[model samples]
Target: MQTIPDELTNIIASKSQKLAYQLRVAWDLNDFLATITFAVVGTSVVSGQDIVKGNAAAVTEWDKYTYENETQYVKKYEFIRETGFPLNSVIKSRASIVLDNTSKRFLPHALPFGTAVEIDDCDVATGWTQSQDGIAPTISTSRKEGTNSLNCGINTAASENTYAQYDKAPSVIDISSIADADKKIALFLYVKDKTKLATANAVEIRIGSDATTNYYRIQIVNSEILQNGWNEIKKAATKVGTPVQTAIDTIRVIFNEATVPASVTLGDLKIDYIRICDSTEEDNYIGSFIRGGRFIKLFSGYNAYSIPQFVGMTDRPKNNIKLAETIINAYDVLHYLETWQMSTGYLLEDHRGDEVIAQVLADAGFTAGQSSLETSMMTIPFTWIKKGQKALDIIRKVCEAENATFYVDEEGIMCFENRYHLSQSPHTSSQYTLDYDEEIIDVGLEPTEVINKAKITAMPREVQASQKIFEKEGASVINAGETLELWAEFQDDYGELPCTAITEPTAGGATSYFKGNTSENGTETDKTNDLSIITWETLGGTVAKMIFTNSGASKVYLTELVIFGTPAKVVKEISYETPDTDAQESIDEFGLKFYELKNDLIQSADYARTLGDTIVYSFKEPKKSLETTIKGLPHLQLEDMVTVNEGSTGETYYMYVAKIEKLAEGYFYKVLLREKVIQSYAIVG
Candidate 1:
């Protein structure tokens, strides 16, 4: 047993001035080692290439590529770099997903399909007044279907020879919040005896700020007219007289009953329940985006393309580098990280407190790893790059093109990982292993969101169709220097044919002839087929011609006239393979969300589909959060893998740390972790 000194014992027993609680704590190299090794160990440099323990050196090259004649630069380097401890190692950081009481689906923007705006006094004459008419209309119960019918008698009609118009103020037709001028407002109503009118257009609806100018008019056609019984009608208002502007506020209903031919007359007209609503299905949200929301509303649901916090300033081209400006490249950044200064032949005495001091402090504070020479000296071969371009932009282009991720780990070191080489095996270090049940303090398991359908975009290589020969399917007889018309339909090629003529002389034993005034002919379509001919050109007009020259007068008969050319480009298609039929059926019933990627990163639709599947399966099919106590580690790192064990079932799970935050003065670490569901690049089955 160890005996404590009187002074120490007195301080421990004293209620005031607790030395243990008052001591300022600081983590040193020893504390770091006890928690997790910040420096690289399993990863090494070979021939100036950074390589991890299980991942081999993979390189990709892109050249001689163009987009609409504009050259593009693309290259990928699958160099495995580790910023955190070995995946299998038991580091101090513990993480899991926090499940909400309920799940919320995210969308891009709120779509207005049937958003309604009611019109006042549409069913009765109380909120309306007739134009230049002395008689007042009354509510007719005989014609009313729902006790909301308004009837205007024959005597109330205005201008017995012209028309009767009922007008409403701009406030009655709301158009203040409408952002899209092209979108139309629809009107729904029920009418009686519209067919008895004299003119073809018995009723007209207009929307505008003024009566004569700046308005749209829609006339109820004969097909939409109600004659014997009541008929419900719905139609979009059309532009009437030339408008001063597209903005509209007032609505007018006009009925030309006095224009009747004297033989036909509408004794009484009845109208019921008029309402205005938006029925535009097309999206009006072009070049408009909602930022800093829980989820970005998308075409079908909510989607956050990029998590802003995880995204860095170096990710954007304009922010990262500028010409004629003193900026640091990745090489200089790495070198600074290594020694906190640029490499020089001779060290300056007053190098301290230089301009680079700010950058050094701004950088994630971490010492150089083992492969500093490899990471700093590595060269990337790109198709094209601007002079003095930002090194991070080059890295981003390469990573995006190759389907890789570029991120700074919690250790403050940049790490690059190609999704193809994700399965490099867990870290071999024994310290990487952790007993989840014993070490985990508390855990939150996000309900898994398993998606069954995925939509992907890819530029798959196409097998071009050879210039096809579209023959007339019959022979034609013609004399030398005489023209004949022939009709033939070509599948894809329509403009012109490659060859001039494809015919043989009618004389026995006469050789076949083609265009170019030579014996040389186009390549044979099939060697096995005897009647194989190349192609024939049209007669410089709408139809193809067959003419025999006087040079070989042998009763020439045109057997075939064919045309040849390539097909149009088509997008590749792919299908998903689901293990659970029930889930697939549910997705089919509910309509799975569309996950589209436009960048031609993957070569084939199959690869794109697989990439989408990998992303959906790995990240948040079911997100989780974990909490753990690490006595030595001070910070949480991205992409750090931690083990979690279920206390009840004893099942183990390996989760990748996607996010982390410090709490209670760095005493605890809370992390948002994702599962390792993406096992392979392609479907094995």
Candidate 2:
């Protein structure tokens, strides 16, 4: 077995080298690594010697690590000369070397256009190769389109293996694209016998590597068909289970007539357009590649990133020694948390039926009752594809809406507690209290400048539902100015027998000129009123109107009061106000800003006001960075609230653990702090 290098094993674990820092800080840096050996949770662990011999495999997690002394953790690391580490902070690491949910390729069910081999219009013998038999195949034009069908003459000599074949060469179609052997494909072709035969063995189709190699044949018994008309035939074939090295090279149509007793000369036959289709309805190429998986290799790498930050947190925490703040890598924090860094997400339907946010977090294996989510159905027709999307995004939305924060505590369980809940909780009962009792090395708060106003603009929700209904209005009558006229309107087609005009009196019936429906060519169906001018003076009538009564199955409504006129346009605007008055004044002071949004996923006013209050509260609790050599709280998590008592005045200040930096070769941890507040009621501005 290969042995580990003496220099690497003897090297001290310190920040003196970049590699050492990674091994100690970002311990779970395998996904971005290459050509290295290690072990992860749920699998076996190997030593540096195993890796050198090329016998080591990849794993998923580095579950636990213990400090060798007060300043060092003697964890084993295997390295190779060709190993590479692309130090990307957000790189994803996998523990095992097995395919999980990644898909690389997909083949569609229906083959694309020109995927099939059509008959050559210029040359009938372009793709086909004649058998070695004495009788050669030729083109038959009895009934032809484009190119005549292929005709293989009878095997006069009664040759056992004589057949006509088509070879798919690499030049014609890129065989590499469809070379997958696991794919099940079907061949379709039209075949007919030129002359009827009394006895024949079978017409068989073969597909595989070559005429003699691994292949399958589908045989059509001669007794199963009549001889004259063209019969469409289809046969299915599957390649071997093991992946093939090359593409399919041959397709053969063997005329197996020699098996018949006293075999007569084979009758002339024709084969038309040959096409290949996926045998299964699904995308065979995608299914084969995805379902048929292989191994995934993971190695060691560095430059790690954290699981996204909490809401209202700064991009970079303020560095102050009093609050325990130090220049620490975010991924180092993730390494300490380990198993507590779990992921969960929910694409809820109607939120009424689904469990509350607390239950969701609990079901996802986090601590129950520590946090809560809003219960109202936020979005209509909510659909989450859920493919590779982080559950943290969902949690972020809830936290932004409900003013909450999530973190894994010292107990190593995910907790979702609102900012208010932590603000009101007793300081003495906190997970960590820094007073005269424990690691209170130094604590100080820094003042931050305040802004007068804050504005949040979001895409407005479409208040109108997706669908609308067209309303019908009552009908109205019209009289040609100062002229005797009869006017009627049918908003929608009733498909009823034509009604006769029953005028108030016989004298009022002024020629009963009617123009109701339009024809296909857009002309009035009955233009009786088109050329006639039946005025009051001409027909001697005070009022001219018609009433209709229909006795038919079809029912319709009157569409308009005045039929021949265009309607006016309608414009609408809706406003959503916040409970905070001072915040609204600031929002309007900047001018009327418009946010044309298409979703109600997040309401803007409350979100903006809450942010404003958080800022105000933040001014009260100054930023502090404490320097401590606290061994017991080595596993402190981000967003964990701890009460800090002043070493001098004994004044209490509750702060959140924003950042942690391990220094002096891991002897001390510098933790950054942020103020926490619980606004029980809505902030006015």
Candidate 3:
């Protein structure tokens, strides 16, 4: 929950109050693009109006100005008269003058890019490594396509051999197939270093199977190829080694000097992208990284003292323009996790609940702040296999494993709290209290469902070892713009186990992974590598197929294929029943009430039993849930403990805030709460 000021708390406790809200959007911190304000009841004076000579008197609210020659302007309005004779004054006749009158309100403006914050400068080349030989290449802020560029510095000694090499993973690159498709492959490099262009004689680019094996070299000697900011240099690579390329593993850049000098250092030689493409298809092969850091800030207060209500990353704004106003709708940072999927081959095994949650958030580029994610009480291992699963789903699964709650707090930070959070000493006490007859406008209470039986199903990975479901040897090729489908049947009678992962163990593995759909009729789920069980009861057993498509200009090669999954024998189940006589009587009166949960993260029977007991104990009896409309309380957060007085029944209830909604132009709050109960036994003296 947010901390409210003492003065503001006193103001809120008063009978009457003033309310105001401000919404701000920006690309980064301290760099605001738009700031809008809305008040409950207020008036604003419109300013900046044009004035004409000999027109009606200036209005009280609008400012007036006069201009001549389109460049000079004065704040006062004036008119002039001409004299015809030297001694006698004469009024000159002139046509009625016309002036443009336009009025506009003053508003904040957006700042220039890279002026308010530092630009992202991380190396964005995925699945690649870099090495330097007598020359240091570092990530630089200057970029042409992506978040950053690579700075290739020259050697201090002129005669020394210096070069920087970027090496791609061997499993993802196939030069043999690329050469077969296009004999004249082109190397596209974007470089910029105007200050030190004269210190180098030429720039040499090398692409090869390895650092010193079969390779191709291109020498760029023209000074025009180097520019002040960014220049795209395209050159067709020529074979320098074995006359034919079999594989591509490394790309090297060298800055050469003609004369041997005492020292020659290229200050800033930045390279954006080093793309290898077919000579005819140059632009289609370039790729870029998506930029982030857009966020929103919401503030609420009375008069001048405002407190931050919500600060979060924003989705794309939806703007609606009408005759009188423009409204924008934006979502919070949690929306990204709901839409983002975990990458292929992402697996977590034998990790704690909090560790798994932290890993998932880190993989999605989010940081968990002020978190209370306690370790699970169970000693069993937890496993999560990422097969096109959303990040939010994984987080929720982990939360369920630990019986915890996860949310984005008001400060745009991820917060995780275990079930013990509310049951703990200080948190078990009410944080605030409200009088039903005085503070609440309306209130209603309804009876909630009672559960007498609870069941939990757990799937543990240790019960069954991962068995190889499919295997293939030798090379398999897929032509450009074509698809390749492979199928395999399950060897054992293990019912309903998902294929976990697909891998290539041979050297120089598959060229690239493509996105495709997976189904018996090719219409169901879509994924990067369509590896799914399409036919469960076909070919006398369970059969699965994977479809691979080559969407690029070059052909793709898969050297080996292996698929593995755990059998369904690992699944375990546990059940619990309420032992209290009152709970049994309520169950008999209301008919049997049941609740069940199936989670792969719950591995131990003890843990499952504890979870079941917690669920059944909380729902053993009918509980009163309340929904009330009350004065605005911006400091209150979800899951906060609050006490509510019931004037009709003359009773007070301590409840947990389940949900909160702002209404009536942010001046009131509608809140839903559930009764909090203690389950432990106490002995009387």
Quote each prediction's TM-score: 0.28, 0.31, 0.49
Give the Å shift of residue 568 in candidate 2.
25
TM-score ranking of the models:
3, 2, 1
- Sequence-dependent TM-score of model 3: 0.49
Angstrom error of the Cα, residue 207, model 1: value is 85
RMSD of 2: 22.3
Off by over 4 Å in 1: 1-397, 409-413, 427-439, 448-450, 459-591, 616-637, 647-651, 681-685
Count clashing residue pairs in model 1: 32
Residue 315 of model 2 has an lDDT of 13
Per-residue lDDT of model 3, residues 1-685, tens digit only? 5777878778777847855555544322211112211101111223431111111111100111111121011111111112111010111111111111111010112111111111122255454454443344556444444345665554544344344344543333455534533433233234333433334436666666654656666667647465444456655667766733444656655655443331333324555545454444423111221112234455566655567655543222221223222122334445556666665434444576667767766665543443445654333353544546787777777777656666655544556655455566555778788788777888888776678777777666543566665565455566667777766554544354443333322222242122233322324553324222222222211345566566655555543455555433455443443354536776787777877777777777777777777777777777888888877777776667888888878888888776676553436767777774543422233
Worst 10 residues of 3 by lDDT: 59-68
lDDT of 2 by residue, 169-232 (tens): 3223223333343333333223344232323535666555555555545566665544344454
lDDT per residue for candidate 1 within 1-685, as digits (tens), equals: 0133455434333423311111011101011112232221122346744332321110000011110110011011001122221121111221111111111111122222334444433445675555643235556433212334566533433444455556666453554444334335443333345444535776777667676777766677666664433444556656656554434557667666633322222325555545444554332221101111001000100111111111111100111122211111111123222223221211111121111222222232332341111111111211222223343443443444445554543222344555443444432111122344443445666643445444455442222354444545545544444444444533333342222233332222223232211111323231111222233344321234434332333334554344443322223434344233424554555456344444332345555555556544543233444444322122224454666666688886776654454332322334555554535544233
Q: List per-prediction Cα lDDT, in the order shown.
A: 0.36, 0.34, 0.49
